[model samples]
Target: MLILHRRVQLLQMTLVDCTREKFSKYEQLLNDAGQKPEFWDVVVITARDDSQKSIFDYQISLKKQRHEVPSFVKYIVISDPPGVKVGSGGSTLHCLEYLANNFGQHSLSQWKVLIIHAGGFSQRFPSQSVLGKVFLTLPCSKYPIQMLEALLMMYISIPGKMNYGVFIAASDVIFLFNEKGNWDFRVPGFVAIAHPASLKLAKNHGVFILEDMISPWGKYRSDPSSPAMVATPKCFLHKQTAEVLKHKDSYLPTVPI
Candidate 1:
């Protein structure tokens, strides 16, 4: 377990170094546009009912350290009702309802929400089962930081990319991207980040088949600062076999949002 954790930290550090320049530029762009780069009005973390106390304890720890958490961001933990087995999708809906009830309908349209689904037991990683996966300690930095803090840092630049809307993500995955290109986040509906992956890896994940066979990274070579491509998915295949993926020309596996 220690070796696995160290490997994760090394990977995370390498990716952060690779993307540092681009992320800095992106944040500067946001600042130039008169926006607070990493500010999320509300961050809602979903947890199992039994994990509520520990999650709150984590929040309190953050408060004790004055500089740990952002002042503009509000953290809310919505625990699943006891004995209720609401899955991720259901928990998301409950979170939305909770927001509407507490913050009121009018305020909903004004605030940018980041909903993190961290409710499940970490069966595969039994070491984290007690504290929940999101609260798992990370060894990337000198100051102690948990998986939740690292996840927030990974997505810090995203709030400035779009208008008022919810950014939903799972607790386990960390996406690293070079933000050199412009991303059109003002699209009408839902937008997701898709990462290139091998067919073997895509087999157990959601795969996006594009309408055209055009390369999304084609412009990156010619113009590294070109706007990133966003396309309406031609089709979506969930947990499909490699044979099925081959037929669909699947190359990019979407990061589960």
Candidate 2:
């Protein structure tokens, strides 16, 4: 199951649209960027809770790409605080705070946000109940998982139009690159990163290694047919989610897998 979080108050939304529409916007935004190819900052929230030795090498890897990391890419590390354990959900909270502090004030007019981490998604497979069995599909329209994707599009579609948006891609994704640089935005489509520890793809371990930085803004261009969307900002977990689960959850609730 996939889950994305967003607030309606943050963006003046429209009826949800599909990938083609968003790609058009991505193109238009680039066109509108004052004649020169534009770029946005990239933020990398590395879940480095483990005391591994290659962490520094990972930083060097990104910096070396400084020449190729795209003018808009800004790699950031949200390392575990001292001895915090990986997968504790602390990384997610800290990642959020770091974004609020660092990119909070950017023009954000033509940028989009991408969070690629090395972790498995929290697989919340619902169980049987009086309602027979609960199917765990993410609601793309007014659903639990896609809300954040829609919110992010709204924010970047109309800068100064949206508040905040985050799109977390599972760490296992290889981030295949195309010189053409095409990204189709569809929330609730990918898996959510379950654990917080990060791994560089260059390492070649069973672990994932993220290789690309996606553009954060300018994905959708057409006006959505639906009226501005209302932010749900719903809590995903039950009353005792924390007590039931030993790990610290996303400061926000997470739908049980």
Candidate 3:
């Protein structure tokens, strides 16, 4: 079953239209920057828990329902004090090391990975729409697992030639998962009411932050069709950015496979 499952294609060809339509805005940004508009295949969600409030319950819930999520979507948790140990060691930093060690063995030349922290950042943008908004933060989008793919797309897309990419803030968090979730992996066609983490694909990951620098003003475009697209921010780039962020090359200690 393990071998057979690995060979199983994680995404469906039929989702192309939905994916493209959802990511049209980012595609436009990429076009403006002359970059390819492609979505990422893997996502790493960085989560943490305080002594007063614990995100571990959520983490445990994810492990119990891991198989239920699509194989393409990978969930991770990084705790401040470090929570339960599923498989990888403790803390968000350790989790990232373990992932770097294990996934390093595989070829990521054709893959892209998005790393997002549980607590998103806040930015102000001029628009008739929402402003002074906190984007991609967990409180805004409580569905961490569901937000994995789409959230990563909101930041940037991974280039096909590279195996690892990151979109971390200066104080961003990186995470990992030791054991897979317990849920069954499957994709559904459409739903009026469903969880965000349950979707097969949301948008393209490659075309994020097409602008070279933070523009003073521009329209913050959000897909009217997608109610879950809280990470939408237009015409402005974060003060900090990276063209091709990698794990082994990053500040974190290199975890060799």
Whole-model lDDT per candidate = 0.70, 0.35, 0.33
Off by over 4 Å in 2: 1-17, 27-42, 49-70, 81-88, 96-116, 119-160, 163-228, 231-235, 238-257
Task: Name the lDDT of candidate 2.
Answer: 0.35
Which is the winner by lDDT between candidate 1 and candidate 2?
1
lDDT of 3 by residue, 118-157 (tens): 4322223233112111122242222443333244433432
What lDDT tens digits, residue by residue, belong to model 1 across residues 64-131?
36455554567888887677688988888889999999989876678889998888888899887666
lDDT of 2 at 43: 41
Query: Which one wins by TM-score: 1 or 3?
Result: 1
Ranking by TM-score: 1, 2, 3
Superior by lDDT: candidate 2 or candidate 3: 2
Residue-level lDDT of model 2, residues 1-257, one tens digit each, is 12112322122232223333553554455345355332224444444443321453364354345431223445555555565355536666666666667667452323444554432223442231111111122353332422222322332333222233445544433221111222233333332221212222212222221221111111111211222221222223323333332342222123221
Candidate topping lDDT:
1
Query: How many residue pairs clash (N, CA or C atoms closer than 3 angstroms) in each of the candidate models, in the order given?
Result: 0, 23, 18
Prediction 3 global C-alpha lDDT:
0.33
Q: What is the overall TM-score of model 1 with all chains considered together?
A: 0.78
lDDT: the better of candidates 1 and 3:
1
What's the residue-level lDDT of 63 in candidate 1? 49
